[model samples]
Target: MPITTNGIHHEERGSGDRTIVLLPGFGCSIACWAEIAPLLDGYRTILMDLPGHAGSVGAHADGDLPTLAETVYDACREIGLTRFIVAGLSLGGAISMRIALDHPDEVEAVLGIMPWNAGGTSAGDPVIEGFNAAYGDIETITAGITSISNDPTKTTDLLHTMPTVTEKMWRGWLGGGAFTSMADKLPGLRVPAFYLVGGKDFVVNQAKQIDDVRSIPGGRLVLHADLGHLACYEEPELVAREMLNFLDTHAIAPA
Candidate 1:
């Protein structure tokens, strides 16, 4: 059953004492977890729709990233998620960083997947450009499709998601200081964190992500070979496997 807490819509699945919260990237719906949810075995999974996206569209706000994370924490508390792991992609990743940083005791681990700094308004901003292209109009949207993936078959799935996106979602990501700028706080994240990136993610600087994670104490970084920004979307099987591996090492306390 779907539940709402603090205006955030989320659903839980799987079965285990430990929980894993899955957060989608920018402009994505809660369905973003469709590919990976079933694969996460032995843990209760919370599939959440970020504020201002999909079912939670009404929850859009002008607050900064930490504020958003606080709202997420409120939802977790309401749902009885006292202790859990967080896995996020892109914009979700930045929010996850804030959550873990603020509540290291409650967040057992953090799985940051292709999470980049969601702050900037430069004309050359690839992320903003991609969004504008996808939602701006017909010609740009068509041109933006192939930029996400090389596979023709996979392109169709991403294309279908464009309509669900909104102007609020755009502001939350591209607007200045929408997120608390995870880039500088990388080294301060005390929770066990796993940073996953792809070789082909053009929007985010992959090298910087790797360097940021390494600077954190015992932070682990993995690069998905031949993949792009949406690794969770493009390679769910590998993402699930890698996520489980990270959970085993960090989330599950050693006996």
Candidate 2:
């Protein structure tokens, strides 16, 4: 087991020299990468539990993206990760970019899977409205999950892990991640960036995501035409394949 810093718990896996820190989406745990982690065989993967999520402590009442980003960066630093790529899904994706933006010299690259930035999904968005409406109701959450995912077992696992989240952490993440935007900062990003978008994702605007990613000088976008918001969970092998290919093409080896 690895140490927990600032209430953020993370553990390392794989023995490869290259390292990539993995962050899960809001309301999710490191378990989000259960299927994907094994596929990343040639890299040291750091699976992290964000504040207020599973295996972590509560979050600040006004925990915004920058604050969250700093907390994550500090935690990684505590673990002796001086230089590495940062990758995340949804909320995690946004934080990964923030890490790159705030600490340019430390981050090798950034990988975002449906990042909730660049005027993507926000507090008043219909998708977020639905999430708000279904927050505490298991039935509504299950229905929402069913609507988005084609796999039942993964859905079950997701729901099984949902109860570990408290109301404060949920709202804190919404205020910090779901309601924030990084549109103004992306064009100035100094590191290599890769964004993966699911065409059928109801939670994020695919067109806006494409445009936002394109705005970055070195950003690359990949569209999964048939996948939805939980693309990684639904097709881990495909996502891992793309991620590895991007890293190799960019020669983002460990420093």
Candidate 2: the clashing residue pairs are none
Off by over 4 Å in 1: 1-5, 117-123, 130-139, 155-157, 178-180
In candidate 2, which residue ranges exceed 4 Å CA deviation? 58-63, 120-123
Q: Candidate 1 lDDT (Cα, whole model)?
A: 0.73
Any idea what lDDT model 2 has? 0.79
Q: Can you give the lDDT of residue 206 in candidate 1?
A: 72
Write the residue-wise lDDT of candidate 2 on 88-189 in tens digits.
Answer: 988889889899999999898999987776664644776676766676899887777777676766756668656566677666665445666778888999
Identify the leading candidate in terms of TM-score. 2
Best model per lDDT = 2
State the lDDT at 235 in candidate 1: 81
- Assess the local accuracy of residue 11 in candidate 1 as a C-alpha lDDT between 0 and 100: 84
Q: Please write out the lDDT profile of model 1 over residues 33-67, one tens digit for every residue.
A: 78898898888899987776776666754435776
Residue pairs with backbone overlap in model 1: none
